[model samples]
Target: MPVREDKRGQERVWETRGSLPEPMLPLPFTVRKTRKETHDTYTLELQSESRPGGLAFAAGQFNMLYAFGVGEVPVSISGDPAAPEVLVHTVRAVGPVTRAISGVKPGDMLGVRGPFGTRWPLEDALGSDVVVVAGGIGLAPLRPALYQLFRRRRDYKRVALLYGARSPRDILYRRELGRWDKRPGVDVHVTVDHATEGWGGNEGVVTALIPKVEFDPAATVVMVCGPEIMMRFTVIEFQKRGVPSEKIYISMERNMQCGIGFCGHCQLGPYFVCKDGPVFRFGTIETFFGRREM
Candidate 1:
């Protein structure tokens, strides 16, 4: 297999002897641990079937996990890149593929491929004020980036997190979010579109909590992830507050087939979301991102 590093970061081409490139091939992994995040979603920790340390990925990258004879789907690594020996995936059993994958218990085997796609701009935002906004499962993809930012808290000026969910039950990591919120120099603001009987905080939308967090719009780097509509509105809110388009980044979720850009299923205008992104500058995708049929 020919190896090359292109726009998609380092490429690890997997090939059989005298055969075509098979980067999409899966490697066996055993489930190490499992914890239910909610009534329907659970976090699964997997380890390489043979080696303790098989692969390392950047904070925001993902893996295509295949259940035995079931199906496959891309799940972002929710754990810190610093501890890559254990791969953590928070899975919501919302559909057939996910249900099949999430049903496996400890010691069940699964196939894994890729530390694929672009990563969160943790390094680029090091010296600037950093703000992370997440919605629902979108937080899974940003959790590692947040871990990296918090690991080097002194390198940046200010760090804040604004998150929202449909309801209290839909929140992914309640305890973790609380712990991070209590840390020095770290601020977290959480809101929900719908609330429970005991809910006591903000109650409109995530954007409602934006003003509550402290950050300078011009000097801040904003990283957002959620539904496309939510991301679009969040970007608009930041732009209205003097944040430039370049410093604002969004993680784009697409129907990714071939993670290395061989397939055209994830095209976004002129670029492929799988290879060119999953993470992109807001200004880069601003044109066709929100169009109804683009």
Candidate 2:
């Protein structure tokens, strides 16, 4: 049996390859703890049994999470690489699989497949201003990029994050966002589509907040992740502000069954969304952006 250790100092027995009929990828991991950040959002802290080594990935990469007998889903690594042993993922309970994940307890066993997909170009953004725009639960993948930037604060120029959700209560990573707001070189602006009583923040579509940001188009990279419609409008807005199409990067979401390229479920035209990217330069994917049935 393969044993996995968790953050809270507990170990669980994981079935080894010999115990199963076919070979299995036994990535020994333990569920450290589960915490609810909001009414429906939860974060899981997973610890690796071995002394964790660096996960060589650019920011914005995602991993395939496998529940013992349930199913698998692609989730972003929301933790920083600076501390690799303990991995963190912020998940929202929207469906059966995710709800099962949310129900996981400390010391539970789970499997992980990758740190796959094309990553956000943090190196390209070096010395250039960055504009990160997120909508709804789309902020999950962007969290890695935010973590990387703040971890090495001097690598990039001014950085700003514009996030939007249905209501103030729906916002994810409220605690981390609060810390980002207080950071000297970062500006975090948030908005809601509808306002509830006593809400004091801006109330409007996320695009409405873009006009207030100050960044030179020629020296900035805009990274966006959101609903297809939201991204469409965001690209248009960036164009109006003189930001080149090539400079804008966007993370696309699709029904990904397998993290590897073998699955056809995540195909987009000639490119496999799982292999080629979940993140792509806007100009590289503009043709498929408006397709009716992508």
Best by lDDT: 1
**Collision pairs in model 1:** none
> lDDT of each prediction vs. the true structure?
0.83, 0.78
Tell me the spans in candidate 2 whose CA falls farther than 4 Å from its real position.
1-26, 54-56
Model 1, stretches more than 4 Å misplaced? 1-22
Model 1: per-residue Cα lDDT over 110-198, one tens digit each? 88878777777776797899999998899999999999999999999999999999898989899999999899999999999999899
Provide the RMSD of all predictions against the true structure, rounded to 1 decimal: 4.0, 8.5
**What TM-score does candidate 2 reach?**
0.88
> For model 2, what is the alpha-carbon lDDT of residue 233?
94
Per-residue alpha-carbon lDDT of model 2 for 97-212, expressed as tens digits?
A: 78888889999967776666667767668989999999988888888888888877798888999999989898988888998899999989999999999889999999999987
TM-score of each prediction: 0.92, 0.88
Model 1 residue 232 distance off true place after TM-score fit, in angstroms: 0.7
